[model samples]
Target: MNLRTNFVLGALLLTSGVWSQTGLVPKQFLSLPLGQIGPSGWLSDQLAVQTNGLAGHEHEFYHYVSQTDWVGGNSFYSTLEEAGSYWFNAMVPNGVLANSSVLNQKTSAFLDYVLSHQDSTGWLGPEVNTTKPRYLWGRYPFMFGAIQMVEAHPELTDQVVNALHKFVALANTMLHNGQGQEDWTRVRWPDFIMVLQWLYDFHPNGKEDLLLDTMKQLKFTGAPWEDVFSTELFPKGATDNMRNPTGFVLTWHGVNMAEGLKALPATYRFTHNQSGGLSRIIGILPLMSLFALDLDRASEGWDLLFQYHGRPSGIFAADEYLAGLEAVRGTELCLVVETIGSYLYQVIGDPKYLDRVERIAYNALPATLTGDFWSRQYLQQQNQIAAQNMNPHSRNPFPNDGPYSNVFGLEPNYPCCTVNHPQGWPKFITNSFLTTPDQKSLVQAYLGPFSTRTTLANNNQVSVSVDTLYPFSDTLTTTITAAQAFTYHVRIPSWVSGGTISINGGAAQALSPNNGLQAVSAKAGTTKFVLNLPAKITTGTFQSRPHGSIAVQRGPLHYAFDIPRNSTVLARNAQESRAVDLQFEATAAWQYAIDPSTLKFINSPPQSGALPSPIFDSNLPPLSIEVTACPINWNIAGSTFAASPPQNPACVGAQKTIKLTPYGSTKLRIGEFPVFKST
Candidate 1:
């Protein structure tokens, strides 16, 4: 393409919400670096723990070199490497001085390893003999980290850019040879396209047309995801397979769908004239819903997800496939992190999306992580009763997951979750606050104790500091130190009905939320706003299980019956290297089912000091619930509780008051419980 043709094409893209300068959809809110918004309380503790644990640094999957523990060929390591990179990249910049941030050296050697070992062919990972065609998927995050480090580590630009060029050249050559035929790769080609798109912005010279043409070939020809997503014809409706077709399996895989969700919105950036093929894929979302019609498939896929497999933790159950909404089925750690990134990074600038992000981040995300962070679960259950292997009973909870799938250990069934899990908290911190798409205002999506520093209208430095333990309390106090006035978009969850925002603690004003956000205009100089987000206990029932098996939710936290457990350490938390193996079998009775009518929500006053640093410290959580219930002799099936509370289970004991703890806080508890009555 000539320069004249390029100019004409660029003009068309600019008019369609993409900036011609970047050749991509404009980021509505630019995510600041890690240190700008350092995490405190549970969120900070998670990252800090990951940094010290196997997920953060210790695991052999990340620093694997010898054959004993290679990262399962290059197919998986590249993705794991990408996740670990985010940890080190964000941690080093988290301090006032970039050189001395938390956990900096842990990642420095890995960066050095990557830069020192790049082959002339552009392959940057350990060379192994295997055919893992999803090779390109691993490169997605490498480029993400590389591009991020472009400014922070300018010395790596030429090397990173050249390596991408070589890799694309290799892909283009293989495509001409008809070699890009990985079943999973065809669906996940978006990952490869994403990195190419980023490179198009950074590397723009003679090969601009070659880059697009190369992407055209790399789109993985024969995969008709458009036809798959064009309508809701695939199997949905949770368990019974509502729309069953021949082999409607791969797309149902949670992690695949989570990564593929970004396919269309991203593909739309390139083809300005949605004329069929990949561009026509945008129309696929309308049938999912209007909100999704404009948004990406993330919303559509998430709709189908929650509709059937939804859990109170704001995530769905997919052990390997579309595991239904049964509380026994556990969500993969891979999907959890993927879903969070899709909401915050891929689909930007929507507070409604944060509702899901906050729930999973606050509950499910950490529930899987050990209190010490030395180990994590390969899969975590919604109503997890025990964490032990329990000798693999007559029933099978995970078809592919091993017996100890839910146990908190080094790498229970698979090691992918270990490497992939670290990305969640670090990425959340980097994007904790979002600058509006117009770049005029900033949005506080996640509620926690974090500060925001961004330039306002007149290039004035503005800082807003939040001092409150959120997801633990409803009250939030924010102090703004600004050189000039700016508009601050405060997000209140869609579940919140009524709340008040008083400027500097004077004259409380009732807030009417629109799309889960309240835009507050902050004045110049020092300004403060105390916004109270109302938290309530919401009751929901199991769709697949027996009727009235309820799950309780308050604010973002899910409530579970605090069943006491006698823990058996399968592997000790030898922090530096070995993963923690904690299996907590019930120490106290767990068969109590709360009477919905008698349940009461109670919260403790905010701690004058900092939130506990350990993961899921349940001794005295920020909130608790009081409820009166009778003991139902619930039966156990396989390694998990019976999928459904027994039908007309005989209530054997007197009704009593039992305290409920946060779902995320419990290691041996039930999120979905059978109400004990005459049944």
Candidate 2:
């Protein structure tokens, strides 16, 4: 049979029962299993660099990763176990996507050890005994890591599911008995609930009651995110205390708030009863009702949170806490990765979530890590000038963070970010594409250079190869090969004004975006199309500095003044010459205000056929913009952090054209710039 006939037959066979096995609300799109999607082109090169950098080497030297409870070593603190879990969770996808045997072997060994060493009581991880005050927080990431592994390698599914079943039984009992309920686990229960939902959907084995009961226990004991977002519990602005009336610290935390954003949507899928009877009415009438987890309310709360606390880098300020919208305030690396993950969860609910994910991934994520990915900053400032340690006596801008908060190092300020940072890029690559609810279509949820091969609902295998220098170039070339006909959906970002698509070397046609997605139909054989998303320079004023200062964006990338810097090594690894800790001091003046009218975007084609090894390096960005700027008296706060740009500041020197590169490329950058007053 031809492709069209096979697709039609497959559609006839697809039933509601086949799609709705979990008895939950239907998602618009479903994530392709791990190993189905792989990175290519610049993205592939980037992951390779990451594998050869700190992420690959940390296991050999970093004590937290090297000597952790997960690997039969002794580490007392729960944070240590949690750190190890983060590394494992990130490496699973990185290894699978990059096809790196080294990473794959290390990840496999860790998984084997953890699965083989499960306690008799069904508890997973090192905290086995109840007398030690068990914390369920660390298990969250480990379970996710295991789930990814099972997705990549299906042979491990039976073992993983059986182990999860045992653990869920024990966890259900513990939660009922008021055990393993800590602050971190309480707010982060959404992650745990997600795992249960995944198990119920994919492999229930007639244990639906147990999964639902466990989910209920978790929701009851967990942070009331639905109530928090709907009521006054949601902070209107940056407040010192984000504790609700009951004294639960949920929204105050940067990472917790980011993770908690998905609680409502996730709960709605399982708990939301669409039958609409007296039970539904009763559930909705009560204040802060358990069944009132509306997706709309969740979206509104997300927007409101970013409105006040958000920064130009597409993340909210959280120097350990919810810092306000001032450009000087820094966002923690943990928050950045969690924010991206939270948005990815909501992409099925709203395609616009992909926009936020791309912005954070391309800008905030790379800017915080070094070009080699060997070191990273605990907190990344929007208008950062230097990465040196601040004087202890000086008034620190990040009151909740430490003096080394912004410095690039192995474990500056904290080790949480060090381990957690690996997840940002790897997850982004894996979650780039999604399948439609009916499985007749594949959606390019996030734009990037990646390829996917997966079986559709019709049981017909389809392969898509996407080649592009996106967020850097306007054109994307996609080649699809399928055994059956399928619809291909590409997300046309809101930033594109003149988008066009040409299929099979035909005439180019205007690309109309519907809810930020454009669809095209394909046959059984190979089909090729080129999508041109021409981006223009877009500028917007900062919320903290609305009048005289602004941030620049083109497509998904944020542009910043690339301040020249001089590096100083603070600490070096004993086994290698690489610096474990380093400081970047600005060698040239960064106090510049730009003339927006004179901004000119420039693209330099690579002289070679391939892109740079580290695409995020200072001198490696293929695109930049030249703008007329002049030196201004931008002051520094606490002798370290850059203060908010001066309102209507006068230029201090002669105006000169300066280059502004992608925010991710610059270590010392001025992202939010003051507008120069020509007078």
Leading candidate by lDDT = 2
Model 2, global lDDT: 0.79
Best by TM-score: 2
- Cα deviation in Å at residue 205, candidate 2? 1.3
The CA lDDT of each predicted structure is 0.63, 0.79
Show pairs that collide, candidate 1: 28-437, 565-587
Model 1 TM-score, all chains together: 0.84
lDDT of 1 at 71: 30
Model 2: lDDT of residue 130: 38
Candidate 1 residue-wise lDDT, 190-232, digit = tens: 7677777767866755577667756655542423343345445
Worst 10 residues of 2 by lDDT: 10-19
RMSD in order of candidates: 6.0, 7.7
Per residue, candidate 2 scores C-alpha lDDT tens digits across 530-628 of 999988888854323444678988888889988899888999878656647989989989998888888899999777746787989797889999999
Clashes of 1: 2
